[model samples]
Target: MYENYAQRLAVVYEATHKPEDFISADFEFKKMMRAGSCSAEDLRCYGILHHQMACYCIDKAVDLFDKVIGQGKAVDKDVFWRTKHQKMILYSQTGKAQKNIDEALAVINDGSEDAEDWICLIAAYSYSGDAAKAYEWILKAIPKFPDKAALYVYGGDTCRDLKKYDEAFKYWRKALELDDKMYDARYSMGFCYEELEEYGKAYDIWLDIARDLEEDGYEIEKQFPMELAEKCKAVLTDHPA
Candidate 1:
């Protein structure tokens, strides 16, 4: 029975790599595992599925991750590390900043200092209000993952947190240079301009963001950029050139 379910899971995994498709598969896998006949490979596959599902269904993702971790040495080392990394990211998203930081550092200490690990470390440190540390780590990580736009965005965020708006702008500008479609960098640049009292520049950036979000059909994200654009417009109105 478990073998049949495992084969079905493999079919689902191969059919579509989309996250939404995996959510129902993850639920089925969990139910099958509860029947106590799953193989190590079955659990490993389930862990991978759950990790991908984290973007849409966080609580179930965490539970599946915990189940995988509880398997201990039965799980492959690479799979375990991947699970830990995903768990660290989940912790960050769920407001467990300190846990995110600690888990990311632990993964690094365990000799997994890949790009994902560095990115997670930067985010965890920034979220924990240790922007200085996040900046330091970003610098260290740049030489390794020089082309990753997210690292530069984190650098910008740390600089902004320190109130160094000019420096933040430079970092975010570099990030946009690497990935022109990186709206987060554009949004951060707008924030830097706002902090520097450059209302016109900030307004233009937010206006672009609002338009982009609307065009992309990102309804929730569209609201923030629209609000920021309006606020910047109000500022511009108050102080005309």
Candidate 2:
């Protein structure tokens, strides 16, 4: 049953990493679907593989997902939710973020589960530059995962994007409260402070990230800290205390 499927997939193996070969994964997935003996792992694999394809070929990926769903197999619940979320990602990738956000809102309204799903839903709205809707969904999702540092960090970034500096600061501070070692959150706080012209505060926060990165045995240049440190120095130089 899978003979033809496997053969066709082999044709595209060499093209996998080529930037010009868009839909390479989809080409492979088509073979898998044709196998007719898929298992739950196959369904999950199909979901993720198509999702990666959806990043480059939304329509084809969506079709692949539809095919996977039609296979009548029991997909893992997490994979199921992620696949559904990938539908929203497909809309976003196709420049229909608002439409996906509207649909996601409807889905949540109809009682969807999973904090991560809600995170992606809010991200869809945010990607479309709709900060208000993003904020709304994030606000709703936060309570469900109150201690999750990532949620606060995401919320803070959204607020920063909206220029809601105070709100951004509040969220970043909350994230630090939950996990003080989150260097990125500390860096983000610096960004918010910088935007607010609170250079002293920004410098202080950047220094904090720098110190933490050093302690982790990672070079400050290994990530974003070095640039941030330079920025802090520049700010202090221009506005000397």
Candidate 3:
């Protein structure tokens, strides 16, 4: 098990392309377990190693969790939760949407209020078509972590899905207030303005977003606000006054 640890650690640090990392890590993890040279202490070590390996492949992580649990080696509770959480992430990434929702809900049922747990719960709800509950959770999270811009973005998305445009605008603008450099907030506000039929205001805000993105070298001109700004320009051209 220790033999695979070095290679797995290297792949994890190079997080840019993940499929390659997962394959290598999974191979090494399985190789160690199959080699059967592990000591009694190797059980605990394997638990930690498997948990990290799961970051590359959730199925392999699940297998490792089973191995740990079966070993009865008395690993940490945090590691257990982390293993479960990684499995949920894998479920989500692999498009097993309901599985993600169910597993994340299981985490919350365990009475853990850590940021990872709540964020995963929120994501599961959003992905599983429960925008109302997702909004409720974000409301709770906002007071819990007032400085987190993700809560605001999630609130805005939930409100928009529910057709509460004004509330959506309020949340997006709140996100901007919390982090003026929030690129999505600027683009989302431009969208909210468009939905409210405030075309001139929308155009101006989108143009501002385009300029900000350009300054940041973000290639934003091909994305939301910039794209919309280009469309608005086309419309304005046909109706030039």
- How many residue pairs clash (N, CA or C atoms closer than 3 angstroms) in each of the candidate models, in the order given? 0, 0, 0
Tens digit of lDDT per residue, candidate 2, span 117-156? 5777787787777788788878888988898787788899
lDDT of 3 at 206: 84
Better of 1 and 3 by TM-score: 1
Which regions of candidate 1 fall more than 4 Å away from where they truly are?
1-96
Cα lDDT tens digits for candidate 3, 1-241? 3344735444473554455665565566567668875556555554655555555566656688776545442576557655655555566666787887777778788887676667778877876678998888887787887777767877887888889888998888888889997777777777777677666777898888777877888784637677788777776667553
Candidate 1 lDDT by residue in tens digits, 167-212:
8878888898999879879988888888889889888898888888
Per-model C-alpha RMSD: 13.0, 12.3, 13.6
Worst 10 residues of 2 by lDDT: 1-10
The TM-score obtained by model 1 is: 0.62
- TM-scores, each model vs. reference: 0.62, 0.57, 0.56
Q: Which residue pairs of candidate 3 clash?
A: none
Clashing pairs in 1: none
What overall lDDT goes with each candidate model?
0.79, 0.71, 0.71
lDDT of 2: 0.71
